[model samples]
Target: MNAINSQKKHVFFRRVSTAGQDIITQEAADLPFREKLSDDEILIINEIATSANKKAIKERPEMQRLISLVKDKKVHSIYAFDRSRLFRDFYEGMEFNDLRAKYDVQVIYTSVGNGNMPASDDVFVEGLLSMFSDIEGKNIARRSREARLRYPAKKFGYQKQKETKRFLHDSSKSKGVQQYFAALKEISSLDDLYKVTKEYRKKLKKTDEQLVSMATDPFYAGYDLEKGTNKLQHVTPYISIEEFLQLQRVNGEFFKAFLERKKSLMCQNIYTPCCGYCRKPLFYKIEEESNSSYYSCSSKLHPKVTVSFSDLSKIIGGILSEIIQNFNAEKLINQSINCYRTIKKHLEAEMDSIDQNLNGIIEELVLGSDDYSADWKQDPMYKRKQLLKQEYHNCLEQIKENQNALQKNKSVIKVIEEALINQSNMNPSMLCDMLINGIWIYGDNLQVDVFYFDYLQEMEKEMIFEGEDIA
Candidate 1:
């Protein structure tokens, strides 16, 4: 075959379970497949250390490279001593079929290998092997889970293995053992000693959290295998048995609280709803009159009822965002002052006009002219006089209100100034809270309204212009 064509080389594939299983020996054993293929063909060997589970293949670098080679059409076919050597699981077997159909890579099994089952029985044999592999994997997981049941009862300690003939600890160096015992004497109880040890850990920048973690871990206990009873040759203990048990109790309570918090955070009800103005999670409320349950945001139920979920309220919210973008604090204050002066001038002019009209009405009344009482009921002059007086007073009130709002808004500028000068080391979750009020699910489409759109837009613009590497 080598003499026939250099490009058409047969590839020999082999695998081993562990480093102890030599690849060369396995290749020599599968010589029949080599003989069947051309002598000119290249050989590719891949060793998988772990059980050839789906996760293993997906993560294995060699298997990934093999797939890449097949995709590139570099290999005409794949040869293995047995299908299990390729993959013990059926999913992987089907993946092999997909490679063959898609890339024209034929699979060859040596007749001498256990993987050399007849071609007719390949389907059934592979399926059975996969089922057995899955069952084995599941059993291993179950056993590992069960072994952890002893964790609460067991304490951390070192035991010399008979085969290795080594003691786990020695207080010989720097009289370290004597020093630890001396320090332990100062503590009134084990708990006090534990606290003192924790303080020492902090000087080393360690935490009680790390200590608690070691208590639950089974690795330091000397077993070579977690799921199986493969005890290693030797082990050493680091902490006292009493301390380890105490650590476990504290850790168990901490973990239980941590899990409960995780569950509640995952639940959707604690989150804000789109129709509320509070931007905070709604609290349940009862309507005493109707005995009906209702949920309302904190802002709506509180003083002044500043926000609502009504259409007009939503429109006002949108307008406020736009106004915040367009009107900076200093500029708004100047504009408001100018507007107030103009309004005051207009009101003064109207007052002047109303005074002239009142003089005319007084003169008519003094003359006792033309049935004045009847004229009051039917005359446009009387109505105009009353309307002008009300308008003047309303204008003055509006100008005063605008001036006050302007002053308050000016005060708000100090907060903005402080924030703008400060560094933004914001947490991601906190940033999310500041932006998203709540999303409204309308049929298939979602309506997302941001409470801080103006600020977000300003930040985004700054980020884009900063020319930082996005990656």
Candidate 2:
């Protein structure tokens, strides 16, 4: 159907696939919706992974915009190629349906019929269709899993059968792996192995998985054996299969445990893309008493620019206080006033009637005898108790919301102030996420580039334009 007022109504489309499939490709495979809307009308297409549950929807930045438009009823209709494109899981599908039905939103399947489609399909039918679709999707997934299990064992660590052996054993590609193992064999202690490997990994920028995989894979020993596939190659082995398996058994266990630990630390710490020193994208660490964790230099672990965890935490706390102090109290108060005005506008008509009746009752009481309890007790003004209670509740809610907003603004102010203070003690971990854009640490010095602090500093120039006096 032709979309009237298309320029004003927003439209959204999404494709969910883990294989990095773009809308262009997906559209080629399956037809997209036909829209007679203007080219200027806003259309958003998000690429998401279907394997990841609906919770993963938050990762797509466009999802938030879609949710806002739905919530505000700014978008009159949402169109997808099919129901699966909208949602695959039953619960997530129900959520999408609820949004459409509750908001009077139209969900149109682009590949299906246009406005001619039945309006009487009903929610229950939609729900049943979605459930069947989910079951079908799960069946397809099971078939794919079975197909993957049928791949040759020789291709396990070597390469996919679809991919060539030349790609796997390419001399240049295997050089780093070969060198790492050669070095590993030369090492006598775990410390030396760690140090050497750490330096090598830094130079290679290899992920933990790649590094661990290279260390454990027996495919390099003329036998390709991994979780799903195993095979034997006619080529000469780099190491015996027995030896390779033994080393993998021992080292694989260690590496797996190490990865778990690394993941845990990452979750606990605030690792920023910005360097603390030099405002570059690097982080350092200072591992003092074995158990204590702190950020140090990116240049080297033993760089003199290192700051202890205690010192970093203290500096951050002090900066936080300073930031809080600099908050624009006048601005916050004005925001509260605006909130109060909005609420007052909503209640003004009711309040006016209440005031008129109240005044009339007061005048009547004055004119009547002091013992005129019967008239006062049966008054129409007394019946306004429920309306007054509603008004009181609305006022209270607005006030609470305004206070919460003010509190949030104050917190941001605090973070800004703490960032500016040149404190000796700062917990690089705690303040790093809040204040730091990047930290660059070199041999003997460190530089911290704080985006929030820098932005506030820039705003200081605006005061002059506004004819505001500086303190």
Candidate 3:
């Protein structure tokens, strides 16, 4: 026994999913006879690494440490209960083979092929076994995903029955669920619903997303995945499927209108301008009853100031009127030409730089090491190539936007001149949209920024240049 133990050295690597402590212990105890080795051949019982609930070999820290031992020539052989217990992917099998060849180490399985060494036939069999394991793992994942989409038995208001695997509503939880649906039906507006939710939130401790899911998920109305429809009569439902659908339709319309109004009121080209004092964009507010909107300073640290839509429109109109009345066609034309030239130069330089970076990445990808094919999916060079491609597309989009803006700027004077010809036809909203870019309000004072095409182009170029420098 002493001679055999001294001549043969081995390390036991055990891994299992949950509730595997007993299985691992039993395997370790039976290792000597199972692998035909003496009991003294066990290198270190205390040092045996066990990873629980880690299905992937690469994701397991303990397994990585064990692999490091093999790399450092600290272990002669690795013993596991079976090959499936060691790896669930073919790539992992290839990696293990590479490690074995590189470090002159061996892996022996107690149950698989009754412990075989690395040879042509053994390698082929191992590859086949790994493929089977990978397929089995994928099948299990697909089954789990399908089960979720089909059953989705576990829910907030219901408990799953152990014996039957059926869902039944808990009386205590069902009451809250019923009350929540009742409130949804009773509320006339989103504001009222929010207020009711706040009261319920004290006890429910549900997040906004969970509350939304509760309101929208068809399960509450007794959804059957097999039929892909709500079977309200099939199971005892808290709310009728018809009522649930009606609520969704109504709320969905309300949400859509709310978003549209928000977009219009907070339009970046017209609304987003810094406060004169605080240099921060004003926060928007709407009075539901009056339908009057106002933009006010948001900072609590700064003195409060509010400006109505009417006042802002008047201020911006006066500024546009002045610019139109004091029109300078030749000066504006020269300015536009100069700005276009500068922008063209900067854009061409940026495009050239992006092209160089992209070519470098492509060159590295083509001339990468022999193992690049195996590792390229996770390689840094591949990630850089994807990022550079995205950046190149973004630059192209910016160039397009800048050219369109230049054309719009050249036509601004014509638009304003025509509006001034018929002074009565000049609408505040129309004028604001046509000429004004943004308006800033400070106490009683207002700052109106009229969009001169040349100035806008130069600002955009500077912004893009600064962003590129930062990147």
Candidate 4:
């Protein structure tokens, strides 16, 4: 659709990847775009407490609505705090890119500054984010996992070892399991088995299914895999291994078997020539109806453009690993510290300048020999003095704010340094933010920008200007 075919209004969409993240941070950053919107001119879509990390853009309801609007050419320009908020999936990026291109929609990231764009315009971020989710989830999961390990799973007849994550026999529950299994073999009448299992179910507070599963489980026969940990090599079996195997051999002998059971780079080190035809970045996506990471370029201008390597994900993974290794865990942390130090020095200089200005204002307040004492309250000098005093108060408040920010930065720096030094585990998002500039696609080759630091200084300036709370 052409410009005449679409509405000339902006859509302000802000979202957090996880529920724990505060959207207010995004709000503070996008004030420049937000303030300009007339009520009818700007459509505000708040996806607060929503996670683009967990749900694809297609799965998100608000996003789906916005997509529909975009499809209808009802939107003119789309404004978001970061591209990450819009998409983290490769295909989702392609999907959105196609829509944006086809409909003539402009995508603007308001938070990008000093000519620095968001690291991942669309694709690599999803995986790296998934990898971060991989990081955060594992750490957090291990904590919860440890807590659960302290007790047995709701499974009958076993308790977990706190430290080793091993299951120990709970005699009371195990007795019920043993009784049910023994009955399963000895009892001939179906009705008799029903009564026995029902009584055991009530006594154990387990359903019939649980009792049957226990009997069928090799755990009762001394071995079975629980989850990710390990299988039981030794156990007080309710029956022998032979019996467990025999039960499985006969289809009708045991209950029916039942079973049940989702990563971009973009700009600074990232560079993309505007598709002059479109705004989407290097697209690495999979074919539909499949859950594979196949690479493809979304550039219509170069329809034949294709990634030259196999397993682009692996290549990206290797790149990420190498980046982390080259930095030696200390490099990124040190760079971050230096950036904050630069900011601190700038703030200190600002405070000193304000102090000097206040001092001059005070000197101006002192009366000259020609001044009349009675005119102090009635003359222009009085007005000037009041203004000077207001200025002094404002300067003091600014110093206090800058001082508070510095203090916060110090505490954060300590925590960051300690985390980097002790755990030695680097967060993927930080690596992407502080280092991976962008992944730009040229006509035939894909470029990965590994060192992007100019924006860090720009970021410091933004923090000062916007009063961003680092803590």
Which numbered prediction scores highest in TM-score against the true structure?
2
Candidate 1 — what's its lDDT?
Answer: 0.50
Runs of candidate 1 exceeding 4 Å displacement:
1-9, 17-21, 36-39, 48-51, 54-58, 88-90, 101-104, 111-125, 137-167, 170-210, 218-247, 255-471
User: In candidate 4, which residue ranges exceed 4 Å CA deviation?
Assistant: 1-7, 16-21, 48-58, 110-471
Q: Report, for all candidates in order, the number of backbone clashes.
A: 4, 34, 0, 10
Ten contiguous residues minimizing lDDT sum, candidate 3 = 458-467
Error of 1 at 275 (Å): 40
Writing each residue's lDDT as its tens digit, candidate 1 over 291-321 gives: 2233444453533222122322233233334
lDDT of 3 by residue, 311-337 (tens): 555555555556555555556766776
Instruction: Compute each candidate's TM-score over C-alphas.
Output: 0.41, 0.48, 0.44, 0.33
Q: Rank the candidates by lDDT, best first.
A: 3, 4, 2, 1
Model 1 alpha-carbon miss at residue 81, Å: 3.7
TM-score of 2: 0.48
Candidate lDDT values, in order:
0.50, 0.55, 0.64, 0.57
> Which pairs of residues clash in candidate 1, taking residues 3 or more apart in a chain or in different chains?
10-41, 157-237, 158-236, 158-237
Our model 4 lands, by Cα RMSD against the true structure, at 24.8
Name the Cα RMSD for model 3.
18.4
